[model samples]
Target: MRDRGLDVLLVTDPANIYYLSGYDAYSFYVPQILAVTHDRDQPVWIGREQDLTCARETTWLDREHVLLYSDDYVDSELHPMEFVVDRLDEWELADGTIGVELDADYYTARAHQAFTAALPTGAAVEDATKLVNYCRMVKSEAEIEYHQRAAAISERAMEVGIETIGPGVRKCDAAAAVHEALYSGADGTGGDYPAIVPLMPAGEGTGSPHLTWTDEEYEAGEPVILELAGVVNRYHSPLTRTMFLGEPPAEAERAAAVIIDGLEAALDAVEPGVTAESVERAWREEIAGTTVEKESRIGYSTGIGYPPSWVEGSVSIRPGDETELRPNMVFHMIPGVWFDDYGIEISESFRVTEDGAEVLADVPRELIVKE
Candidate 1:
């Protein structure tokens, strides 16, 4: 806070709240904040009275710091911000510069207004939305283990997905088998719900990246793409693989090879001194004159997340992103290609090591073709 001249900091992003205070709950839909000050060593977690028990169980904070407002404050004419502001005033922080998350899930407009109105003095609120995210860019050893476990779960799920999907089978049924394997995880350790459900888009629908599954039976000669993650301790190891039921068209095979080659080229460029865009350029150069092409970014940072999406919103591996590669940082390198008729996605979740990127999954990086 001193480095940024922030007298107080209010974190409203649930992922960030969990990052700072380890306060995880299904209550991120409501207004919550983890307050920090330079004067104190520990942060304060603020949430609804109903969730205080959850906070006590999950957070490392002292019982006193796990604060709560009355249940009467839940979605009423008076917002939870009123009580938060009152607490700030009582704590003598109303006159100080408070940093608030502007683009956060819980930092709604009403919450912003309440905080702004409560600070009568020149006490200002600044945008610190990406602050905690940037801090969490690199992973700790323990976090890597979590992601590795997640990757193990993902590998088994992919196996199930591959085995269960075929001609005459319902798409949803195949998705179910994959889901079962995803949640079942590896032996001895159980997996948590992923930030995203299995994204299994098949045939012509593959052009749409986010499509799930259907009740329709799989047709011969069609391709299916599976994009999903295995989550453990909120850290994710996402993977994607495409499969063809029968003999894949010559064009499909060629496109998959080009993508794999481009991805390898991109991976080769990932080292401590390289820039994010420079890595992208390696892939772009690899597919420069090829029939296949990809316009979207090929990769992005990934780790600890909540629902709606698992994208690490902090940094992206794309053109114009000048961020340098750092050790212990993790990413989902997706060279997802969408054609007019269908799409192909073969991705890997990996960690940046001192030498290069270490892919988490042991699965073969190619289009899996089976008769």
Candidate 2:
């Protein structure tokens, strides 16, 4: 807040709200805001009146700091910003220059307009979405531990996918196995829901990055791309790999090699003080002579997230992004390449240390093939 010249900050992003105050409930489909001021040690968690019970049970905040607007305010023309304005007045922060997350997923245009108009006349609303995300870039020791746990779950989940997926196997059955492994956690440690569902873009659809599965049966000689995350306490370690039901073509095998090499190159460039784009540039340079090429970003920051997505959205490992790396920063580097017929993706979630990057898992890097 001080760096952004914000006397008070109004955070509407559910991820940020959970990060700041531990207010965990899927209550963000409606409007919610976490208020932070220079004067208070604990930020106030505000949301729909019905969600207050969840906030009380989940958050670390005292009930006095958990404010709620009436349920009547929702699903009506009435905006919850009016109650936020009331709280600002009650807390004596009504006239302060407040920073709001204008770019956040939950902070809609209507909400922004409604809240901005209700603030006191002298007060200002500034775009500070990046501010919180930037602060969240570097992981603490505890956060890294959670990530390691999530990584463990991710490895087991990948194994389940590989075991259950084959020619004539129903894609839904494979997806079900994956979900079991994901939420079952590892070593008796229970897991949480990942920000994204199992993305198993298969056969001709392998080239598409975000396609979900259907009831179609797997076919021989077809490639299946598995992009999944293992979540622990909301921390994610997303992992991806390609599997083939039969002997993959020589070209497909070569593309997998290129993907792995490029990903390693990017990971090697992820030490402290390096630029984000430099990582992508390294991957591109590594694959220059190869037939594989990708125009999309290879990676982004990851950790501490909610439904809708797990990408922290602060930084990206791609061209034109100049965000510098620092120790304890985590990233999921995916040097995936897509051809007209298929795609090959092998990714790693690593942490930036002072010396080098620490790859989070020991999973096999090559495309798995089964006859």
Candidate 3:
């Protein structure tokens, strides 16, 4: 953070706040901001009075530093200049460059406007979210442990999901089965977050990679695709699997074989020096001769928060992404292939190891045809 020429880093995005401070507030309808000095020690949380208990319990904030306003005090209504002046007075901050998250919503921008108004005679503001996120890309020991537990629950849920793929089961029913399995909690440890509701789709429904469970029914010998995640401890590990009610139809079987092979090819390419794009390229090369349509980028970095990464958004996902793969870096390689009317998705969570990548979940990638 010091290298970024920042005096303080302000985090207004709730997910980013949870990542840094461990304060998971349910009321995302309003805005919450975290102010941390460039030294990156002791983040001060400014939020609603209703969240005072949550701030005190979940965050490392000192009681005096956790500022709260009443429910009537809408953050958006705060004058940008007055809010900045107050924070400067409270923190005894001198003239220096303040930093904030660029992706932070309009409320954060309003805060920035207020700060600019105060200006403190000669101060600057810069976007520090990228720098903070770059630090978050690598997993800490505690973060990895949370993900491991989440992944284990997700694996158990996958087992139930696979079993529910037979003809009599509906997509909604399959999702419910997986949800119940994950909610049961693996190793008898309960979760802090809600159980995941999987999206179990079949046939044409599988064309949409992010499809949700509907009233679709699974027919014998039809391909069934499930995108499952277990949200635990405010973190999640999502995995995808495709199966057949009985034996996989010829087209589905072939697509699954190709997808499984591509996933292996991608995993084999993951190493400390490898770029995200290179890993994706490796997967694409494996499917070059296959008939299935393929997207360029294959996967993303993973973390404790649900959906720590995005497929299409401000998050970059290309080969030149200089973010080198490092040990303890978790990622999801969820590559699925669709051919004709058949689709199969095989995915797993992985943590980059000293030598290569280690699979976090034990769910098999093979086409499991339940009888």
TM-score of each: 0.96, 0.97, 0.86
Q: Supply the global lDDT for candidate 2.
A: 0.88
Q: Model 1: which ten-residue window has the lowest total lDDT?
A: 114-123
Query: lDDT tens string, model 3, 1-371?
Result: 67877777777666677777878767656667777875435787877778899988888768877877665556455543355457766666646777767765434565666667766777667776556556667777877887788888888888887776677667777777777887887877555553234667676767666567776677776767877666666666778887776776777677778888888998998888877788878887887887666764567675644332322122233456656788888887787666666667788888888889888888877988876
Of 1 and 3, the candidate ranking higher by TM-score: 1
Give the poorly placed runs of model 1, Cα more than 4 Å off. Answer: none
Please, what are the lDDT tens digits per residue for candidate 1 over residues 231-345?
A: 8888889999999989988999999999999999998888887888999999999999999887889999989888876787787989999998889899999999998998999
What tens-digit string does per-residue lDDT give for candidate 2 at 33-150? 8999888889988888878789988899998898888887898777998788888888777888778888899888998788878887887778888688888999899999999999
Q: What is the C-alpha lDDT of each candidate?
A: 0.87, 0.88, 0.71
Better of 2 and 3 by lDDT: 2
Q: Evaluated with lDDT, which candidate comes out highest? A: 2
Off by over 4 Å in 2: none
Q: How big is the positional error of residue 151 in model 2, measured in Å on the Cα after superposition?
A: 0.2
Winner by TM-score:
2
How many pairs in model 1 have backbone atoms within 3 A of each other, for residues 3 or more apart or on separate chains, i.e. clashes? Answer: 0
Rank order (by TM-score, best first): 2, 1, 3
